[model samples]
Target: MLTHPMPDPIAFQIGPLAVHWYGLMYMLAFILFLVVGRIRLKQAHIAAAGWRYADLEDMLFYGVLGVVLGGRLGEVLFYHPMYYAHNPLEIFAVWKGGMSFHGGFLGVLLALFLWSKKAKRNVLDVYDLIAPLVPLGYACGRIGNFINAELWGRVADPSLPWAMIWPNVDQLPRHPSPIYQALVDGVLAFILLWIYARKARPRLAVGAMYVLMYGCARFFTEYFREPDWVVNVLGWDISAGQVLSIPMILFGIGALYFSYKFDKKAAPTNVAKPKQKHAQ
Candidate 1:
């Protein structure tokens, strides 16, 4: 069994200011989003449609707002409502740590919708473009979680080679869930979605795959993860994360169905239709 290297949460300090690794990770995620977004804009169709740097910047701003607010609320409501309900002010103390992916996802959706409305762009297009970029960012966030020694996984068999001991939680060996999530939900998902998005397939296809892949990854990883709390539903043990992911999977499937059923290709706003040749 490997002992967990519980790195200090604080990355560094400058006199009066303390910089945290988690915050740095988030910043890195945002920066990578811009980089990926630029790559996305390089495509001829996307470039002609005006997927501009300014628009990307604006979307990032809105996404930050959504992530912070939605993550905090989700942590409060979904995981520890009773605790937060009593100490309500702690909810604002994000620096202490607490975030939910599902909440952030919803928050991103809302942000995209608002931005889409203003830009007169289809929200699904924005979603598809952004989806491929998200997993790596998610991977960074999971690294942050690991560094903080937070969200430790469920106890594991002593014989497991990679089983880790988080002294903060207990001396017992536990599944290294954060790493599992990072690889499966972040790296694997990124690869799959990135490959799928490389070529245009159908409207909403990339975004739909993103939702489905992430849902499946999170659900599967939850078995090894220590649940924030377990709910007894229909005589089944379900983690909070799994519960939230279920909706995402269903929504993804529905989106794919609509994309195929409608048989529409996503096109830019100003795309010119081919001129019809009159019969000779």
Candidate 2:
């Protein structure tokens, strides 16, 4: 028989501010991004010509807006369109929880595109730079899910050694999907991006790699993840994540091919030499 381990969502409280573990995870994620991003700014390629740390600061601000708004809207539309439409006010209750990764991803993509355009940067360069910084935040979100005991996975067979019953899900022996996601989507993806992005190349490759890797990981994991209350099945009884991932895989393959073909040469260091003009 399975049982629930109900975790305390609230970590602590400071006066009137109720500090939740999920919120604390978010704070830690942000701090990690700041630390990593600053280090990235000092890299040779970033220090050269036009890229600057200020760009990173600007990007963080815009990215937050994109993630929060896009994630919330995605959850409302993709998962519970009917419920939210009927009770629209519930859409803004983000603190109550319900954000989608796909939505947040789209939001981040759009935000990066806009930032690249404004700064006159190779869009992929910005993407490659930020890719490594993303996964930890995602992992943190999964931790939050675990703390809240939401998004439990499918039932396990009786006598399954690792099976657990989440108290939040009526104490059913469901898979710990958050932990799985934390490993593959959060930790593994971070390692891949962190290793690949440092290469000296046109940035499209890494950006595409990030998308492809994330799509593959998420698509595979969705099998274990429970479907949204009002979502699933497209034409042939498949998950929404699988449907969304197909195009990403294609794009990733294309980008990787091109990066290898055109930008294989190692990127040069940023050391500068003063102009020595010919005296006429």
Candidate 3:
């Protein structure tokens, strides 16, 4: 871990077109998903749903909308409803900052539901296929947060090597919550979900594990994250991230349970077997 005070957000500049690292990170996240998703789709389980490589493009296109719109909306509604109500113009200034992970999660769910209906595909099947590819993008998002240095962490002991002293906050060393999230949510999440999804059995497993795993990671990680300035409630001392993660953990628990219980239902018993399109 080198300490050069986290790089500046700018990637490069083309006259007035100044490219930000945050934006670049999103592009990279999506590319990683595209590359990984294409390979996974060809697997026997995904093939059951007849997802072609082309489908990845269409599906991810919808996801982009979900992430942007839902994230921005979630921030406004969940964290700063009162403030935004006072300053309506700030709601449109997403590039400046403010987005909620839970909101974006909801957005993607809706997008997938619509995509499933239009494609005549089972909703769970698509969810399972897409779950593994999500972590990389999420990781990239955290990296963006780090670069912006907006979502700083709680106060920490100076002896803490990884403790970051965000001048905007106090000089005290503090946990770099974004980095922790990137490791847990981004790196660990991708590895675990990808390995688990290789076979793609039990459609519920993928979506459920995604909720469970990310929720757990996020909930725990939120402990070190600083509270949003907008909400300074007493006693709880918990951040909004932790509150949002609770539902995800619950949903994950339910999903995994059903996946196990219904594992027998999707079996090839009189019901039609999944078609094999790719002979290879």
- Highest TM-score model number: 1
**What lDDT, from 0 to 1, does candidate 1 have?**
0.88
Best by lDDT: 1
Cα lDDT tens digits, model 1, 25-66, are 889989988998888788765676677888889999999888
lDDT of 3 at 104: 89
Candidate 3: stretches off by over 4 Å: 1-7, 229-236, 265-280
Per-residue lDDT of candidate 2, residues 100-134 (tens digit): 88899889899889988988887778888888788
lDDT of 3 by residue, 97-141 (tens): 566888988998899889889888888878888998898889888
lDDT of 1 at 20: 88
Error of 1 at 57 (Å): 1.6
Which runs in model 1 stand beyond 4 Å of their true positions?
Answer: 266-280
Where does the lowest 10-residue lDDT sum fall in candidate 1?
260-269
- TM-score, candidate 1, is 0.91
Using Cα atoms with residue i matched to residue i, what is each candidate's TM-score against the true structure?
Answer: 0.91, 0.84, 0.87
- Cα deviation at 59, candidate 1, in Å, is 1.0
- Each prediction's RMSD over C-alphas, in Å, is 4.5, 6.8, 7.2
lDDT, candidate 3, at 39: 82
